[model samples]
Target: MTAASRPKSVYPLGAKAVRILVADDHLVYRIGIRNLLGSEPGFDVVGEAADGLQAVELYRKLRPDVLLLDLRMPHKNGVEVVRAIRQEHQTARILVVTSYQTEEEVFQVLQAGAQGYVVKDVGRETLIEAIRAVNAGTRWVPPAIQKQFSDRVLRQELTAREIEVLRLLTRGLTNREIANVYGISANTVKNHLNNLMAKLDVADRTEAVSFCLARGIVKPEEI
Candidate 1:
């Protein structure tokens, strides 16, 4: 929601190198992804993008077997990028990699045709296995998100911190500003926003704010 944040198959079973495109706005994170996937035996890192716009362009040009997408990028965001890519190519196997574990975030991309939803802090096995599962035609929703899909997730309420983040977000404070207010990292601010989005069942901050306002979660004077 604020900021945060792959691969492919076969030849894993001994076929061809599974081609992949890694897309994230952070150069360091992108490089880390490349290094990890590149080290794997059958995974091939083909192309990379620093923003959602470039990601779409690169995806069109390369058409890799798998696209490792970050949820919150500058130009398009992962959800938009997923929708765009799918509109162009329906069979695109997109593995969404992000720090946001929100139900709405995960469900949004998967419903838009993402093949998998993986948290950024996942271990090597989980990451690699998720990539393989998606490439193999499985819709991978790990335990973290799978549990959130239950009835209880829908009934869940937002935390005080999440409400604070949502209020600031609607007030036009950037993630960094929110982070400063909370004395936390920008990434943590994003995580809080993501949690708010999930609890509120909204896609982005604006939607969350609107829902909150309409539902009386925040007073009009507050905004």
Candidate 2:
């Protein structure tokens, strides 16, 4: 049998299974996730959706315990689907599972009502943990992302220039481009970035952006 024909296992255990719906445009990836999740002891793969629209439809129809959403898809994207679901079901428990790990994207999903966010590159163990945490009325943002959120809430020591630099960073602009945009020297941009990182208590640009979004310093739609 070919890889495509491999069997997909479903786990049936005594624990109250967390019903799940997987949404992604890629057929193989969706199926792979179903197989992986199905093999877990307390997860039920209730449905699969190939796009955001379909995901929303399935969410309404199945009301699964968790909605595993992919950020990019044909005919609406994850953000749209999340909004649609939340509008109809205020108590929705959505988890964004996507390939893009940028702070801007992560922040947008959470603001849209996602209980947790996990990057596609995350290990299977971390992925499972995130799902469990979200299902248990808890949250699971990366530590770096969490720090950004916390700093933003307290309006910590970030200076005006640092905020500008951080906002530009969320836009995914290069250091040189940011400098040009602000009429500053490249070295000056680097210095601002260093200070921003220090003030945010983060070690890198990604974390800073995530922090900014988590704290509402930068709106996701603006990115």
Maximum-lDDT candidate? 1
Cα lDDT tens digits for candidate 2, 1-223: 4334544334455668898999999898888888777666688889999988999999989999888889999998888898899999988888888888666666667778888887788876688888888888788888876755554444546777777787789889999999999899999999999987787688889988887787777778866
Where is the poorest 10-residue window by lDDT in model 2? 2-11
Predicted candidate 1 versus true structure: per-residue lDDT over 138-210, tens digit per residue: 9888775775554334334667777778778778899999899889999998888887787767888888778
Assess the local accuracy of residue 110 in candidate 1 as a C-alpha lDDT between 0 and 100: 73
List the candidate 1 regions with Cα displacement exceeding 4 Å.
Answer: 1-14, 150-223
Alpha carbon lDDT of each predicted model:
0.82, 0.82
Candidate 2, which segments miss by more than 4 Å at Cα? 1-13, 148-223
RMSD to the native, candidate 1?
A: 14.5
RMSD from true fold, candidate 2: 9.4
Against the hidden reference, what TM-scores do the models get?
0.62, 0.64
